[model samples]
Target: SQKIEQNSEALNIQEGKTATLTCNYTNYSPAYLQWYRQDPGRGPVFLLLIRENEKEKRKERLKVTFDTTLKQSLFHITASQPADSATYLCALFSGGYQKVTFGIGTKLQVIP
Candidate 1:
């Protein structure tokens, strides 16, 4: 079955700590994958992306890694704060980016 999935329902982390989220997909050879952060009432905001040729990508406190063999991607946030709490989604673009699929999204709660 071709499906994308996030780690779990919700992730709870303490302030100043690091939060790691996982995204796994099967039976899809996507050219690249993207991550987005979505707030309660707002649309998802682009976070980061990793190409099939790249092993990892990082921006500020956020890091994303792509593993084509395992068909998995990992998202990390360092120095997490309560203000960073949101639902994170992973999208897969395949067939020349014509087809796209999304995970169920994982909610992150950074407790102060």
Candidate 2:
């Protein structure tokens, strides 16, 4: 079975610094990976997506990297502010049927 894992604890960072979050997977080959941000009591909003064949992707202040060989993905937010603080999730399709699996998500808190 395919499984996704993210940091179980919340991360605290000072405002204006770069914040990095990690996602790891096992037992599956994914065609693409996606990142999302979820606020308390709210649904997740899409942030970025990276294809398996792509080494890196970027959008404005956000960046994502996918390393198929390492079975890991890294998400980064530059010049992070309090508004960037949220629970970040990683998701991907697995198996022949393309079932989607999401990581547990890692919470981030940007302090002023």
Candidate 3:
């Protein structure tokens, strides 16, 4: 059984600081991993994707690192602002027609 775990608690941080979040998994052999952001009452939007062979991936103000050996991923948001407040989700794509599974998400709250 594949399982993904993230912080179920909300992260409260001061604006302009970096926010770090962790994602962990069990029993899954994913071909790729993806990160997504979700605002209130809306579906998640894709952020970054890292293949099994890739060590890291990044976008503006965001960086993600994957450690397949440990079955974990870390997400970082630098200079985070109030506008960056949202729930961050981690998903795994296992390939071969298997449906992807997403973590419950960790809510980030950047205080202004």
Specify the poorest-scoring 10-residue window by lDDT in model 3: 92-101
Angstrom error at residue 2, model 2: 2.1
Task: List CA RMSD, all candidates.
Answer: 0.9, 1.3, 1.0
Overall local distance difference test of candidate 3:
0.94
Candidate 1, residues 21-104, lDDT tens digits: the string is 999999999999999999989988999988999999999999999999999999999999899999999999998977878899
TM-score of each: 0.96, 0.95, 0.96
Point out the worst 10-residue segment of candidate 2 by lDDT. Answer: 92-101
- Which candidate achieves the best lDDT against the true structure? 3
Candidate 3 ranges beyond 4 A from true positions? none
Model 3 TM-score, all chains together: 0.96
Q: Identify the superior model by TM-score, candidate 1 or candidate 2.
A: 1
Q: Give candidate 2's root-mean-square deviation (CA, Å).
A: 1.3
Colliding residue pairs in candidate 2? none
TM-score, structure 2 vs. true: 0.95
Give per-residue CA lDDT, model 2, range 5-43, as digits (tens).
899799999999999999999997998999999999999
